[model samples]
Target: MTVVELEVTKSADELAKTYIVKGILSEKKEDDALHVAIATCAEMDALVTWNFKHLANLRKAELFYSASLEKGYLKKLEIVTPMEVSNYES
Candidate 1:
């Protein structure tokens, strides 16, 4: 895996806010939304996380993807755990 130097960009911030506005994420979970937003804006193919409660589940994935699409992030981002990628099958 290559190092990806990512930051909290303006577009990411706005997208994160959209997640909050849509009630997909709470403000207290701002960090979670920001993480997703950043990866979405960075055009990442996937974002590996162990936080299954918020970031690495199917229900949350649908919500996050919908919110991202609303913000013009057309590409789908896979939010998965390390194990998922390690054992991925296509």
Candidate 2:
């Protein structure tokens, strides 16, 4: 798997920081980790993970879909567990 850093502009960083401070955005480690995956999926094709608690959970999936729609970021992105993708081939 390739790891890439997503660079945000100073203004964007400030906005994100403000969101965190306002309590509208989550600052939990799990949430932050999933956010990174979401960012990757938004910019790339897919995001593979085993983080069921944060990223691969069905409830979180629904939330992600809704959030993407609300943000006008409904793109062709897949967030799946490794087993889910592996099972598809079998």
Q: Write the per-residue lDDT of candidate 2 for residues 23-48, one digit (tens) a residue.
A: 43367643454453346344655667
With candidate 2 superimposed using the best TM-score fit, by how many Å does residue 59's alpha carbon deviate from the native?
0.9
lDDT of each: 0.92, 0.53
- Model 1: lDDT equals 0.92
For model 1, how many clashes? 0
Residue 42 lDDT in model 2?
Answer: 42
Candidate 1 lDDT over residue span 1-90, tens digit each: 665889999999999999999999899999999999999999999999999999999999999998888778899999999888765545
Model 2 reaches what TM-score against the true structure? 0.54
lDDT of 2 at 26: 67
Residue 7 C-alpha lDDT in model 2: 58
RMSD of each: 3.0, 5.1
Point out where model 1 deviates above 4 Å: 87-90
* Worst ten in a row by lDDT for model 2: 10-19
